[model samples]
Target: MAMEASMVKAVIFDKDGTLFDFTATWGPWTADLLRDLADDAAHADRLARAVGFDLSTCRFDPASPVIAGTPGDSARALEAALPGMTLDAIVRILIERSRDVVPAPAVPLAPLLSELTDRGLALAVVTNDAEGPALEQLDGHAHHFAFIAGCDSGHGAKPDPDPLLAAARALGHAAEDCIMVGDSLHDIRAAHAAGMRALGVLTGPATELPGAEAVLPDIGHLPRWLDATT
Candidate 1:
């Protein structure tokens, strides 16, 4: 059974798609990366297919492994496209280049995060992104989170409860007292697996996902949902 939103004391957020507008932040970067690495238009298509990116639209496919998969997973998917490079080489390049991409926040982060913090909710970030790049992307706003963990940060990635459980403990809250807010099913799975409530946002490609407890248009609508659900 779901508890009232007012009872929640901490929030665990997914970085991409949830906090940052997924396509707006990643689409152009992926397109540029695909072009930079590919041999030609045909090669670009192949590369795009490998990562589940659509070059013509510059948007990621909903089923794209890159959307929720780790950077290492993305590198392995790309192995067949690049002949001479090893997976480790590709992963290094991806991580190095990733550090250069600035995130486009879904809403003005300062106010939204301030609102949450002001409500006495401890905040944390859990992302499938590598810890280094994930921290870099948060930039000035990293201060908002009490904890931030990525796939490389010791605990296992999402769809596994380890990181979520750790984040809740780090925030000094039980899983049941926290909410996992994100834009992917991976977030939902991890949240549920960790015994937390899951809230979804539509900042990514999907209009609606099946497993979310509630689906909002974006994180901006969270206060309203909290109000109504309370």
Candidate 2:
């Protein structure tokens, strides 16, 4: 079937899961954080549970706020497990640790992004992460994005249209001429609220997103969609 018509001038992506493989990138970080911050094994378990992560499996549950929330949200969740740590301290640690993370791309990023750009499509990222760490993670590939914003970037987070709208403006495109691609419901909701089209991918924990126009295996398929639609 034909997808959207050839009107999309910009593409806004969700960072963690859409661009990179979320679990492969963040599972170790969360596990280490739990163990390091917790006083003991039981405490680690509490921290894990608080964030909806599995210590044994090193996997995040589908509903984990960290999967689609800001660093502040995750920090507050962790604070419930660590009585001694203030939200500020946890956020600092998260940002510090996040700065060094090695991202595992969901697909080859350079070529994919280049393909989209080569087609004259403006690209941007709107994520629930902090601006600092999100930039750090995308350092080498940052050139492909015309704009990048996180929750702390003053645009607000996903499930809200502000950030997406901001990115669209930065990319110099109208909301109707853009698409938001991500791996969660938050992405779809943001796109809908912003009046852009939405596409869902399976690189993240969300296997189904009822709000998306279509769900594909990963971003590798995006070019095809663009081709068909355009």
Model 2 vs. true fold: TM: 0.96
User: What tens digits encode model 2's per-residue C-alpha lDDT throughout 45-89?
Assistant: 988999999989889999998999888889988887777778898
lDDT of 1 at 42: 97
Off by over 4 Å in 2: 1-6
**Candidate 2: residue 216 lDDT (0-100):** 91
lDDT of 1 by residue, 1-230 (tens): 35334478898999999999999999999999999999899999999999999999999989888888899999999999998899999999999899888799999999999999998889999999999999989989999999999999999999898999999999999888889999988898898888899999999866667678899999999988877775
Best by lDDT: 1
Stretches off by above 4 angstroms in model 1 are 1-6
Which stretch of 10 consecutive residues in model 1 shows the poorest summed lDDT? 1-10
Each prediction's RMSD over C-alphas, in Å, is: 1.5, 2.0
Candidate 2 worst ten-residue window by lDDT: 1-10
List the global CA lDDT of all models. Answer: 0.91, 0.90
For the record, the alpha-carbon RMSD of candidate 1 to the native fold, in angstroms, is 1.5
